[model samples]
Target: MPSDAYRDIASLPPALRFLAGGGEATKLILERDWSDHPLGPPEAWPDILKTTLSTVFNSPESMILAWGDQAQTFFFNETYFPLLGPRLGWAMGAPFQVVWADAWQQAKPIVEDAFAGRSRHFIDLPWKLDTDRGKADTWFSFSYSRVLSPAGDVAGLFIFTNETTERVLADAALRESQEQLRLVNATLEAQVAERTADRNRLWQMSTDLMLIAAFDGTIEAVNPAWMLTLGWTEQALIGKPLFSLIHPDDLSHTIDGADEIAAGQNFARFENRYRHADSSYRDIAWTAGPGDGKIIAVGRDVTEEKIAAEALAAAEDQLRQAQKMEAVGQLTGGLAHDFNNLLTGMMGNLELLQLRIARGRLDDAERFVIAAQAAGRRAAALTQRLLAFSRRQTLDPRATDINCLIFGMEDLLRRTVGPTTDIDVISGAGLWVAMIDATQFESAILNLCINARDAMPHGGRITIETANKWLDDRAARERDLAPGQYLSICVTDTGTGMTPETISRAFEPFFTTKPIGQGTGLGLSMIYGFARQSNGQVQIHSELGHGTTICLYLPRYAGDALMPEEEEAIATAEAASGETILVVDDEATIRHLIDEVLEEQGYTVIGAGDGAAALKVMQSGARIDLLITDVGLPGGMNGRQVADAARMLQPGLRILFITGYAENAAVGNGNLEPGMELLTKPFTMFGLTAKVAEMMKYVGG
Candidate 1:
């Protein structure tokens, strides 16, 4: 019936035959009744109009054409769909004045110039239109050109438009951001000036070998300690190349440390041998930092201490080896008992599932399948907990309101702590937003409450409070954190407290005080690692009688936070035609599984087992829409190296990093660039598909 509506399309003149393949626009043009239009029937249309229509229909950019002496009639292509609103239903072959009535006044002069044979271009031309969502403001950058007949007479107008509303708004936002950055720079300059004065006051009083050197390692000045300790007068040390006095073997490390400081990283503590006035090598421990275009350094002569340290280290190594063996044996027993139990559930169900399939017992297989899946999920969770303890787990950080997140978890917290533990929540007012992984934060809080409950062993009170804090230099140093604005979530318990020894070892992995069979000893350690990985700190306050309080301190996020209602609207990914993906993994099972999943979702997948093989595929110049790679790879190259090389070849390639843990210093330590995303191992098929869909939204945009 639909084909019958356009049955006469085949009878059109050869000049109009170009309209045959322009998708929905072509179908509408062919089926429309052109008899009453001023342009008349397609058979009578001019060759210029026909050819121009063909071009308009095939163009990938938004285009509209107006023909006839008065430029009354109009036509557009599929690319112009977005510009159409409620008028789209009657847009095809509609009068130009009726279709764009809202913008006609603003467009009239440009349209007239085009009809008079002069082309015009406009940028950020503003307009207002009534749409399904009511009135909306829009901006467009476009060009209007005249279409002429063979006689060279001005005939019609052709317009190409690109919406500039988003760009216009973004430009305004960027100006605001730049102003804010200028203010921040001013504040930093003042802070630096103040710090410099403090350092100047300490320069003469300090009893260390303090010196100022040029970036190129030329010593400029030295304090009195340098002359007293190294037998070199201040005049002798000054004007000398600092590195020339170092032992040959220490040159490379010293140079590397200098290079790092030049590249803007704070110089780490360093040690090297420096020659004394008598040509004897002195083992000097050094600390250095960049200061006002020079390197400010302090060296402590550690020759005596170094010898004592070497002897102590040798003895400590043997003690550590014996302790490690004992700890490993205990760890093995605990892990073996738990893992074996979990494996039994999984393997037993899988075996039963196979037996049922062989006996054709389809109905009985569902239970076994579910049981096996449950066991597998538990094992995956256990593995994640272990990785969390080492801060090696992948984290998906988002800007979040800590108060809102905790409010949402109130019900779960109460239910988790049980009826005996009275829960109290005190959310901080005017709390600054934080960037964190919400799921892991919730898990950490839950673990703290569980530990508190176990401490009481009876009815107790758990108070959770939040507050904004500014940690100055002294406070920050005590917490082993940098000075800054931080928000803290503190949990306190009215229960039996920990001894100083217990408190000190609380965050050590597998060092729990609970009975061996009752605890895995990873809970507190996981929380500690998670906090550190998130650029935050966790502190414990407890004594033998007083209640214990544990607080997690996270740095404040400066940017606008994405609230619940502001989540990105990402459409489910259904692969477009010819979308190809390349999957690289060392494990055959993982590679095949990814290949099958993507293939089922209508994607063409290419598989490679190692980084070298994947690079070869990239070099082959095949079209790759997405690359899914495991971070840990064999054959001398890892996933990050492959991705970096692939980006060089194809800068816009989207990457999905799949990993068991943060293994290759793990995906830039969770700082993935734009167009890149990460997925942890043991992910469900649904999670894999969903993440892929979310990332695909950035493709070609």
Candidate 2:
């Protein structure tokens, strides 16, 4: 072997210290023929190269030192034997480009960077190597660093490398095995994580209070939401009895409900108050169910909601009260203004009569008297309309056929509306009987016809229709009426209709679209009040250019209708027999007038100013045939009390009540006792006599 000749180090030249005693690799280096080599002989080598060569030859790790331009010259130690295989002998002193000729394409850039004074490392770099067996796939890890000359210029590259094929292949096999195991477990683990993550997120982040409580009301676990909602930490709530936090007033009921839940029952909703951290109570609405020896409860904070609901109810009540007050104010103002005008006319005419009679112009007195009487009548009519709007007017309800009533009023309605408007009456066949006041109904129909006539400046059609209506729940709600059979009397007009604003306030008192002096504004409102007082409803449907329909829905009377009574001519009525009557009124003028009227009818009339004066007269045991009293009196006891006292004194006494406006309770809600009747104030002398005559007849019969 060529290495046997280099055994004697003393025989070698002095400059050959780099080829000193190493192993077989150093002997082989000394025996190499380098006369024609690019680096020449070791004796002619640079000191840095020789020093680096000695280090490379003696080192244990696989290392290579490449010198010169392009790092073409190479020197390696015996460690290369395992990596380079049979190529080691020639590859030791060869240029790296030639030694790794097959891998030069991948190695060239690294060599260039080292020459440019840059260093880089690669781990598990892959390569294809030709071997005795065939092409082999291999891996290597190496670091390439620049080596500088003494002049500080990059002259070569120093590399450290190791063959890592076995370790790299072993790691790949282990990773492949691990990936197969992971794929096998992915489905079940993903499902479990999905469910657990969702539950944990809901428990930790939800706003609603969530907890698990034992069957005995002990809290086992609580979500973080307990801290956020009620200012109690999860740790504070856990192991605490749930009933301990409940309000004292709500504790018993809450315990009962919890007991129910623990007994395998579900409570859809349960409300209770819980003590907050600040010592105030919060309302909690809980939904709970029993689950496997525990109770799962979800509670929602409803304190603010409850407060808002109560506030809304209070606000609604306040609004209704405010509306009522406003209506009262409007009604009072209207009545005062209109009554003052009527009073001026009446007083002026009476004053004129007084002046004429004093001046001995007796003939002129009758006209003034007539004028004052007319004004008085007008005032009475105004009071009646106002009473209708207030829904306190006296009603004489009877079961009457609505179709016959409309037919009977057809001619009168046509004459009242004048010649311009056309009247069309479409009365329904088999119309149901309505329990309504026929006189008031006729007046309501007349008022509607007059309004329809006024609506149309030019000629238009007025339709009066009667029908049987069966209002369902939804329909009844729209009309503000209860669901039942109703007799509908509708008056429709083709005229200049009302706007939305006008229609909305059509039934409000003193709310009219007519010119100020021309309308009292009580027409529709009067009809509305009258209908409601009769247990009925009225609705107005109108549009700007279309037309208007005013409907009256009167509840159907189940009984058979009776023929209306014939009105008697009471122009010259007088008392049929001698009768003693008592008249009680706070107003002296009214009391004196009633006394004169009764006296003129050939009856003894007794007068008193107050209820006490009347009761005193009744207590005197005088023979009183009848009692006529004003409902309102100045004394502490009203006329009704006087009547009661008089009845006790004379059990068979006939009583007559009179009032400026109908006081429903004062007049027995228009349900006078037998042998009793009512007469509204401002009654004519003729009417007063007629009522007395009829009562006298009842007594005589």
Candidate 3:
């Protein structure tokens, strides 16, 4: 069936034996068609071609042997597959001119010289190979020597490809010893010939980082670009282990990659870090493969690309945080506006009921009054939390003694939490005074205490401690703050602590660990916002099974502490004669409550439904003693717009603007003229009356 079935391959010359046993080469050499071959069947090849093929194939180097007068391929080894890929389909018995037509122009003269008995050596000769993936750029260092017949006439040629520096140089050195006159008269003479000058020029001029390494990991040669990129000379790179120049972190992986290349795997886009001469590292992406028992590698630097990718990630995180804050502010601000209106109506009516009971108009109303007061207080607490979470709360800051403030809350905290837990207060000696809104600071402390209490449903200790902290540059960097003095207030609780993931999001608005309905989830978020607004920081430390601690660091105020104001007793004096008060509100209950209270105080009272209605009455020349209006009212005007319009009619009107979120979100940062004051909603009846009396006093003067 085939010549191989009848002949033992080992009995043949080494070149014929190699082709007979090669996986694909054997099938191509003995099995493919050669009926039209100019040199006839492969068995009929000339003796010079047969021996030259054996010599080229037996060596562990890439080679192609072209035989006969017509230049037909007699043999090629497995290592030549990439250069001949798809071309191998017709390469078996085809003429070199037909199979390599795409590159025949550059190869024609080189082959002609070898057959003419002129030996030649070419380095880094460039060419292209057309395969399934299209034209590919390639280079080679090869030598062509004449193969002579027994009668001394030139019959064919052998091309020895120099894939790596060590193999090609070693071969060149060996040929110099035995191949004296034969190479002198053959293609070996081309090393000093004019035809090779262009190829040698190309070798020294390439800008790509190209290198050759032995299978055992010794570098053999490198191009000029390697020196430019890594600051290592070619002579320095040639004698060192290839992995020595690699980063320590990448050495083991690079060693493994070299093994893959040694096993004949072609690689592309393989990346690793390489060490530079300056003791830094450069990121490189490599393309490598095995060739002639060695490895050829090409690398491209990718340091800037990696840096750009990291920058993009950080920018994305900032955009996400900004978007999240914008969304949360819109939601919390709306809730505060609606809830404040409801609480004002409920608390105002409750106060009127209490007054009626005092006058004996109703009996058996004490229990109802107590329960309603507690519920109203709870509702007011929730409204404040929403306002703080939205960062729309108006704050009035004053320097205060932190130790005195903590001591004042002791009795109230004990009453609120019952006797289930013990309260401990530890104040620092000579602590720095903090700049904060005194009233809002108390609320922030109370919110933190309530959260700590919930974390420990069973009996536990709640410790409130204060200290003076002077943060240095390193500590300030960790907290993203400027180095300065701060007043530290810490609350510690013997409670179930939070996990790392839970702690990370603990300050996000509406994020809670407690069950639904048990918490509104705004306690920590409000505390966070308040601390930030005071030019301070808030931090939490916890573990899953241990206890938890939360710290608030407020800026140390340089000014002197203001003395706490003494509370004034409610006045029993009646309003002055002929003083008329104008009350405007959308809610009928709140409007009626104010009208009734002022009327009982012996003052004339008029009321309206909205800002538009209020302005109508003020324009009618009613000689109103004062104008009191809700900030968010129905009709085409808000409180601020209505105030602007009314001030034009009566330039010196005594206006008291009532707000929930309006002071921060609606009126913005603008100055008010004289004889104007602001009062937040959900105020006690006494507080509203006191403000009215104070304003009337100012009007009379």
The root-mean-square deviation over C-alpha atoms between each candidate and the true structure, in angstroms, is 27.8, 38.2, 29.9
Lowest summed lDDT window (length 10), candidate 2: 566-575
lDDT (0-100) at residue 119 of candidate 2? 86
How would you order the candidates by lDDT, starting with the best? 2, 1, 3
Local error of candidate 1 at 663, Å? Answer: 2.8
lDDT of 3 at 254: 89
Runs with alpha carbons beyond 4 Å of true place in candidate 2: 1-198, 214-220, 235-244, 248-270, 287-295, 309-326, 565-574, 634-636
lDDT of 2 by residue, 397-446 (tens): 76788888888888998899889999999988889988888888999999
TM-score of 3: 0.47
Global lDDT of each candidate: 0.82, 0.82, 0.75
Cα deviation at 135, candidate 2, in Å, is 80
Model 3: per-residue Cα lDDT at residue 170: 49
> Clashes in model 2: which pairs?
none
lDDT of 1 by residue, 393-458 (tens): 888888988899889888988898889999999999999999998889999999998898888887
